[model samples]
Target chain A: MPEIANTAAKVAVAMTVNGRLVSAELDPRTLLVQFLREKLLLTGTHVGCDTSQCGACVVHVDGAAVKSCTMLAIQADGMSVTTIEGLAGASGLHPMQEAFREHHGLQCGFCTPGMIMTALDMVARLGPDLDEATIRENLDGNLCRCTGYHNIVKAIGAGAAAMGAGAKVAAE
Target chain B: MYAFDYQRPAALADAAALLKADPEAKILAGGQTLLPTLKQRLAQPTALVDLARLPGLSAIEKTAEGVAIGALVKHAAVATSDVVRAAIPALADLAGLIGDPAVRNRGTLGGSLANDDPTADYPAAVLALNATVVTDRRSIGAGDYFQGLFTTALEEGEIITRVDFPQVERAGYAKFRNPASRYAMAGVFVAKTADAVRVAVTGAGQSGVFLWEEAGDILASDFSPAALARLELDPADLMSDLHGSAEYRAQLVKAMAKRAVAKALA
Candidate 1:
């Protein structure tokens, strides 16, 4: 049998967030979204719904898109997490973010961060040549109260193309 | 989400010891359902033994029999795996029809089978395909594995290590999903082996997933969509809610079964 430890009020958690290694002591109940928004002040990841239905809290965990609201902060220990804040680098904006702006994908801009995060993960998995049906089907987790999905879909396609071109240029 | 001790044991023996020590301790696998249930205060576990660190439980391997999927394998992995798609395309298709891409990324096959949600899609496939539920303690056949809603043959401290699915001659699954939750309102899995046929219906059953022996018998002889045309399911044995009436679910079960049979034949 394994030695059992007394229950502690808080546990130490360390993880890589947006290319930087960070560590913290947190209550066991602290969710990943709460840790990101309240502790790190990376509030770009929204909480449109506390329930897991809304993709407003979507982020990339180890290069795969996952619902942040459904995962505990401790569960993400030692893993790498990429949030909306992580997208911009030396480049002014990510291709997906630029495409959203170019295509007028947002009215309230609440779901934009998650949309962009999910779009990037989609591009990573499905490649840059995404179709209308594929984008619509993959967007099942996300909900836009403004119902600006038409523009959102358009932005994802354009962004995917730009990302492909950017990768090509980088390779060249 | 009440306060609880969290442990990531490196070995299965240590994880089992943790669960044995605390009866209220829950094994956290992927946490897609448990975390949501915790947030709602629906369950109060004293500790969460995370299986993330446990090694050798996330692989999908093709075997001489069929395919053996590790318990910690996520839904997305199963849905996108070339091995699974080649061996059992129906299983791959079923995995793809789960909640969404994000949910699929975090949810696991072991987690789904352990929860045994009546509206889940895995139960149907597990039953229809005659898969084996392998745990730390014992190997349970699909016939003896599922008991009822949110119930399984798993004992306390018994962690499912993997599941072995036998390759069938042909199999297919179809479900009418609840628009809001995307859970199946009525789902059917039809499998045809060398000598036998199996039809498992989920979501519609009041008790849980069950084999439609009559439909299986009819298909065993005829093996076509038209073979199930004359069959009818009794509404009294089904579930009824705001989303659908018991009568509605009964009809859906037959319709989905027909579609599954057609897919298998196709």
Candidate 2:
């Protein structure tokens, strides 16, 4: 057998996830997706493709949306992390998630949560006025095998509208 | 994936020192390639130096000279950033056109250029922009950095910190993407500098990436796609793959070069 590298069973890592401080004992080789699923038990982040090609394991890392599958759990040490579960605030559901549900945005729902997270990031960047082509182009990262994306686009548009209306209601 | 030692050093120098000390260690940027390779068991580095946590490396700044994009900057940040877009809209376009959204969010300039995948979008534009890749140790020209398929001039433990692109007067990038993967089947970067013109063609060359010499010659004559198409790229030297044939890619090179030129001038 070849000589193996050092594999310390447990390493201490800290993270600020969704406005909360967290520390966990993690394996040296543990991936972020595995950590979310196994260690932290935050299973809203799904792992569809081991390769970064599939956006099923998407999350908001340090306020930017990134594919969680591609990252190591240790890579996120001392960082702020957010999963699909973090999208909803004190409110019942995130406008994007609500819009997704209202517009029949999910079919298998395997890719829905990540879709919502990625759309949240996109909405944060492009704002409520994102057009159809830009939405399609921006949504290219998330893959939904079940839904053909017709309703997903509508969901994003409606989500933006909902977000915009919320802002208006808050102003009043 | 096999177990491995991992380090995330805060300082850029500390990261470089770690690599310099360990020859077998690989630099992990964005994990767009390294993690996938690890999962597939194609690559198992004894140790990985994660560049993600390094500070002062992901800066996209504009000086009087041109734009300097940190190697650690993700493709999505590059695509969405107004600073990057204003300086090199073609670069933003190239960044957006790279793999789907997930890949863009996770892939960094250094990872793509370091991997030097022949079909990657950055290398073509990097060469076309005549960007200088700055490593912890040295600054390498775009021509020198790229050698061939899966090849680069980087030495062991050399970490690319940033890429400095000399702002061109007008530029346009066009790509005929592989439908499924979105990697450029054939892409062209056409720039109109004050002194002269530069045309770099990628994804269609067996030599990996080549300057369209004949196209440049035509552009020198008229500086238009219509003028450039008069001089055709030799299909014999082009790359033939599962995606496209040598002759067909050669034609696309001509067409894309023309479109890029038209877009730049427009």
Candidate 3:
């Protein structure tokens, strides 16, 4: 159990994060972003813009990519959440992470976590046959000021293929 | 964010009870807008009645008349729903265009309609499609739902159950989004029903989402983009901001209406 709120307005929340069942007592007003970063120490989900415009805090809530900044911790009670840290298996980096590394997809790496999380979602939804235009369109939510998106787009396309192959390997 | 008591009632009836018990309680839908508002201290509620656990409130079901989307249905769900695509492709497109993917995954139909932000996309669809907003207490016509900017006809304790959209002959929606924020600068939804034609506009009006009666009347007789050639919106009734001038929005209204009519006919 984690204690994220000291106030009397604390509410109990139990949720799954990164394949672990974590429970905490937090303020009813505690945002999911704060719960993840301050309480759970999952700082990989960055908070670039507090206004929900920047997708740096994007994470999977019950398998859908959502801005953690805009959601309350209590809202996620009994839900499954996956942050950027959860992408890799015990063996090595996730295929998407490998694709980004191979393609030089990051610059400052601040937006990489959110970008990777968003890419994982896109690959899951659209499958491996993602075009440049679709990738660009889908990246509308995540903003990266450094890479100019050329390398990031390439990384996502390559990552999509690897993820598809990875799924096939597991299925086999 | 201000401290508040959180309540997650398993049943809608229990949720309504909690709401009725606490006057300062607010219904927490998807929390895309409400949470941000709370974080900014724009609103202070004594309690938040979480409706996420309410089972039937999130379902998308086809009715005898048309499609009924549960109030808790997220924008992404609506955007990707097969039923919505088959019954109302325009609606799906509109849902897809709302905010971004992450925002869409969390923003709900009920929250959007309940908040009734002037620039919101759903109000235009509700108005143009002549949908029925079913609430816990009673049903409200789409025409009567919206009152003004950030306002709706819903009572303090009323909870929206679902929105029922009738099967129209054809419908289309188009919007010019503000690039930075993605809020609609000017959005229009045009629908041709069995008995009448409706044209609704969101984002451009100072008084909030409004019906373009002049264009709707013209399209009722002659439903085509060319039919709007003689029609023009009064710039005085439109909103002017840094993104666009009143005159520009007036022109956009006509242009978007034309495009919507074309899409409906397509």
Candidate 4:
């Protein structure tokens, strides 16, 4: 185990981040967001409210969306962790990200990364053809302080449709 | 957050042993609540024995009695589990409404029940469904599980293994959630079995989650929203915060109860 620093306690964490396997020895108190930003230097995962309230720290742990700020780095040991940066491929942006940019879903862009991650997860869970009320209700965890979320909701709907079409193409 | 010793024991026996050895040890079930508290410096534990690595603790199955939900079962799992949705749709619905998608994905049944936050949504379901909380040592009735605000019948070092909610004829949960944080301001859960009816209220209790005996009695007789007409809660024991007054919550208790009853009927 590669220890990071000299501390009373250090937890060895080895996990698949994005598509790469990364390992580090960190303090037991280090949140998953801290591990992503400080250790891996994947700053795409923003930490808005250190408290779990704001969804700015949302990430996919084992394919499920969870607030990274509320999770300890050691807790995600051996789990596949996906941050916002993982969404885009080499050639193009992820459908959700493209949709947000196309629809102007953000202003300050602080909450965009979490929003996209959450939106993609929502589509995965709820399916492609999401209604307006369902999309609004599904956005309980994510909050965009800018643009009043009108465009964000619209972008998610369009993104869901695009993802469905993309899946169809892949299937074909 | 303060640095602490972290142990992820693979076996339930080992996890229990780790907890028993340290006086200031805390069990990390989901880290949905404990982590936030630790970040705020409200709690400082010497060690956290994580139970998420333990196998067979996330199973959600329909049993002869009811739906048996393992302690490690996440809220999203309960909400989306076909077994849970089929056996107890209302329970699934209630789980679906807890916190938000991200929170639900990580939060677990054991963590919620063990913490017993007064504003929590699971206690209402547990109380109204008359669920049995199965621990490593013994099984506790839902009525006896919740003691007070942020308190439970769970003894130190004891871990909840599973929660068994009896299959009901019909059940419903309704809540007016806090806009910022999805925690319920006032929530009600009503469940009707072949022989009995239950009405449990959460979020507005000063002493924490409790059963509305009067409403239960009324619903047991007629089982309708109108049955709660004469129901009036004593504001003296209800919670009052910046969100709402005790009087406001008392009124909301009745309103949510009515809506829950209507939903169950629907």
Candidate 5:
């Protein structure tokens, strides 16, 4: 039997979530998704499969998107995490969020948060001028049960372009 | 997931000490595979020793022989790294092809190699490229490292530090992936060095990743896809499951090899 199973031992975890420094004493088995949804009440990130296959629990860790369900909260100590809630500012919805709305990229909206988070990471890494094939290929990890991927792909392409345009305006 | 002690050791020696102290301790690299298994209750580890805080295990440097990639180097880093692309573009391409963007961001070369999943992509590349697995204790050649499915020569408490891939003249990889899971149903990696041609096949082998010695011999002289038109792997040596039959995987291995060779020539 595992030793910790008998004890009420909890690990201390501290990290920056959505630009806010948060800390909690959590069980070592607590996943990052559990930390976000159950502990912090930041329930924007959904758990579609609870496995690594679906990207519904996708969130940014230290600037790179990762599946939160597969990572333990203790493992995320001292790291910075960003979820869908962090995407928008007082200025309004992020360009990617706006693009999803304009493109009707969602049906049930269950996978929207993950899609937007992954889209922003893609734009940050692959640049804003993403092609159709590139967008489809990059969406391999994220699955939409509503089968609304056609519009999701369309949204990502338009979102990428808008992000590029927004960057240009900021630079000027 | 079962409750377990989580220890983050800042130094390599400390990490090794922790593992040595607890026989049931498991090292956490990227946690891409281990965490999933734990969540499913397939493993009941007493403790998890995280290597995240350990330094000097995440560098990718170009050596005189080839490229030395730290074990903790993420798949995304290898895929986008200018150094890896210049040294071994096929490796970069293979890394890019793993899972999805989010997976690539967290999966590491060491984690993949250590787990030694039968359908994993890295084993084919490691074998074909003639890489060396460096550890805290000793260096292991690729030929002797992989034993079978989910198995390696690593002993308890040992940890992989980095992998040194010797530069090859030409190399390419191609895989027939299970569409839903994105794991290789049959994958082939072909490499031509200064003196020899090497071919490694993964996902199809019944015993795990293996070198198609006959294919390598034929390619050494001809070095073309047309030369392998008549070659066929015995179905008895390939895997069969709900995804594909042994005969189907046998055919896929040959087809994927041809495609990989063609890609190398291109």
Candidate 6:
């Protein structure tokens, strides 16, 4: 909520990330991508483009997926963010990750993390009715130079189905 | 990006005051534009006013009049919000069509309107919806808000607080997306208000967005795509680049406008 202050001003920023509180004293110009990669050593988020064109740097801010490259560390102050590394638990890989592995959705695996994060958000909102057109429409933002999106779409469907089945099993 | 001073204020007044104190400082919303520009060294601000900590800046409120979108609300939030999807589907459509997943998740409507990129989709919505751009100091209407390409009425350090779109009878959005960037090659927004039909075209215009009076006339009379075919697009006003020609974009504006009307009427 900070307003525009004098150019000489500096401030401390703190954020709760992946259920843990982390604090940093950073230049206001430090991007959230730099902070995550260079500072916190969370290299799970990749930087594919200097511009915001690629979805490689996507992360979750307060449960909402956002591009980390387009954000500042200070902007995340007092906020909560979830990155790719945070998706897995002691139980093992998140359902989306397992599905990607099973589906051969990745070739080089560079875009896998961002793709998985985006899939998690899309499945939660779109449910299983996310047909081919819907998946194409939804994933237009995340680019894949390897062009491995055909399987990626299938993987997302399989993952959502698995998650749905898991929910059903628990309910039963 | 070079290092600079950063401040986070938890209140609106404090943020406004800080902006008032430092005109050179840039207000950070989603950073989808600012960060990239910074990395490109196109824009270098000595100070950064981080607005993410401010409360009530990300809410989508449904009022009796219309819908109010907070300035800091992400494009993804607006595109998926129940109220926006129901009240102003074109706004939601425009929000959903922005760059891509990452861009939509971090880009804000306010930021899009403020940036005034010719290829940006929200300007068409702002003009067609006739929304009010409310800033820290005053409110500006869509008619006068967008000056030209990559230009807006906002003074240095001014922050857009909320955008208020008055309820219209029917509205829809249509776009011919650029293959590589996914930005609109030409996008049109058509809205039928109680008083008159408003048509706005973006991406294919030289001056960013322009009023499509002929298309508006067509909508006012028939409100259909077939009616749109009768109106002619002047080649003088269309934008041209690697993606399309001025004449090509002019035709697309008409085609997209027709499609938008068809969708709206449907």
Task: Say which candidate scores most in TM-score.
Answer: 5
TM-score of each: 0.97, 0.94, 0.96, 0.97, 0.98, 0.93
i-RMSD of all predictions: 4.1, 2.4, 3.8, 3.9, 2.0, 4.5
| Better lDDT candidate (2, 5) | 5
lDDT by residue for model 2 (B1-266), tens: 77777787889988888988888778988887788788877877778888887888899999686899999999988988898889888889888888877677778998999998777888878888889999988999998988988889998888899999888888888999887777787999897787677899888888777788667666765788778745767899888988889999988998999999998888
Candidate 5 segments exceeding 4 Å error: A1-8
Ranking by TM-score: 5, 1, 4, 3, 2, 6
Number of clashing residue pairs, candidate 3: 0
The lDDT per prediction is: 0.93, 0.84, 0.92, 0.91, 0.93, 0.83
Preferred candidate (lDDT higher): 2 or 4:
4
Q: What docking tier does model 6 reach?
A: medium
Candidate 3, residues B92-179, lDDT tens digits: the string is 9999999999999999999999999999999999999999999999999998999999988999789999999987999999999988
Off by over 4 Å in 1: A1-7
What's the lDDT of the predicted structure labeled candidate 4? 0.91
Off by over 4 Å in 2: A1-10, A89-91
| CAPRI-style docking class of model 4 based on DockQ | medium
DockQ per model, Cα: 0.55, 0.56, 0.53, 0.56, 0.71, 0.52
lDDT per residue for candidate 1 within B196-245, as digits (tens), equals: 99999999998899999999999999999998899998899899999999
Question: Candidates sorted by DockQ, descending order?
Answer: 5, 2, 4, 1, 3, 6
Q: For candidate 4 chain B, which ten residues in a row score worst on lDDT?
A: B1-10
Any runs in candidate 4 off by more than 4 Å, and if so which? A1-7
Q: Please tell me which model should have the higher lDDT, number 5 or number 6.
A: 5
lDDT agreement of model 1 with the native: 0.93
For model 4, residues B13-73, the per-residue Cα lDDT tens digits are 9988999899789999999999988888787788899999899898998899889999999
2 versus 6: better TM-score goes to: 2
